[model samples]
Target: MIRLYTKNAVLLAVVAAASYELAAEFGPWPALLTCAAAAAAASAAGAFLLRTSGVGRVTWRNRLAGYLIPWGWRLNRGKLWPIPVVSWAVWTAVCGAAVLLRPAPDQPALGTRAALLAAWVIDAAALVYLLGTLARATPGGRVGPIWKLVAVIAGVISASVGLYVGGQTTAALVVGGGPPVVVGGGFGLLLLFVVTVGRNTRWN
Candidate 1:
């Protein structure tokens, strides 16, 4: 279900990016927004699947527990604990930067490129951490190194490009032919990463 939906989401994103501003076609706005929504929903569904696929009910239930056991300190779960925090912090910083760079008073509240940039930064940080963590944990005995390499390469290049384009573009969303391409490419890379990680990992 999630797989088919995710594919559909990506397909929508691609089609939207390609047909924007045309006379009789759907615009990029719908495509990117749909992709963003789908990406978030798909990620959530995948995470739930991961927790329930035999990691022990205790582990799964504890995840929702309100107790702040302190992941990087008090809990002592894994060496990878700091990665989540770092990822979140990076995202927060980018968001803060965006707030600082907000557009003029007259622009649409949400049309402020800064906010969008912030969101992009947050998403990029997450993608980097999630896929990067999996790639790191991937052992040499089972999954080939190429999968991890693909994760790292695809994650970094696409994310950096997307963020850069988002940050660099001027007020006009369609002024430069870059933002849509960057995001579309980034999502494509992310889709690839998800597929590869799912295929090559035991945490399935």
Candidate 2:
């Protein structure tokens, strides 16, 4: 049960974070808040699952989690931080959504796309922070520079998403406005490359 809870926490956190980012990019405040709420709920569920279960009857993840850690590290192995962290993420995501829902004045005015872009950037950053917290909380959290490097790269992705979103909204006056969807999508794809190939680089 503990193992399951751990795995569930890790899984829910990462997915929720990613979902928040994607939803922000697409727009619609209700959807973003819902995604954030689900993530927070999942984290709590994981905690509950942990509290009730014994180690012997726990999951395979518990067994493997230690192995994933470095030679001298240990996972926190509880519901406290994970649940609260997730809750905060959801809270922030909801705030971003609220800000987004305020109704943009117009494209040319100091509203509309600006609010939308701000929401996306904040949402993306929140998710990245959530993911980083989860990564650092894991059994391997204390070990390698790999996690730090990966975290840095994830930060870059957030920045890229923000820049892309801003560029998308302001493209009309910027000489050439490539579609934001295309640019954002491309940036996301590039992240996949780094996560796949660079996550294990010498620096990490």
RMSD of each: 13.9, 11.4
The list of candidate 2 runs beyond 4 A from truth reads 1-27, 59-80, 83-155, 168-204
TM-score of each: 0.32, 0.35
What is the overall TM-score of model 2 with all chains considered together? 0.35
Q: For candidate 2, write residues 1-204 as lDDT tens digits.
A: 698546644643454445445555665566566665654565455555545557677575434432222111112344245444544454455445334333334424545444444445343443454555555574745545555655654554455445534644453222112233556679999899789987877873
Instruction: Highest lDDT: give the candidate number.
Output: 2
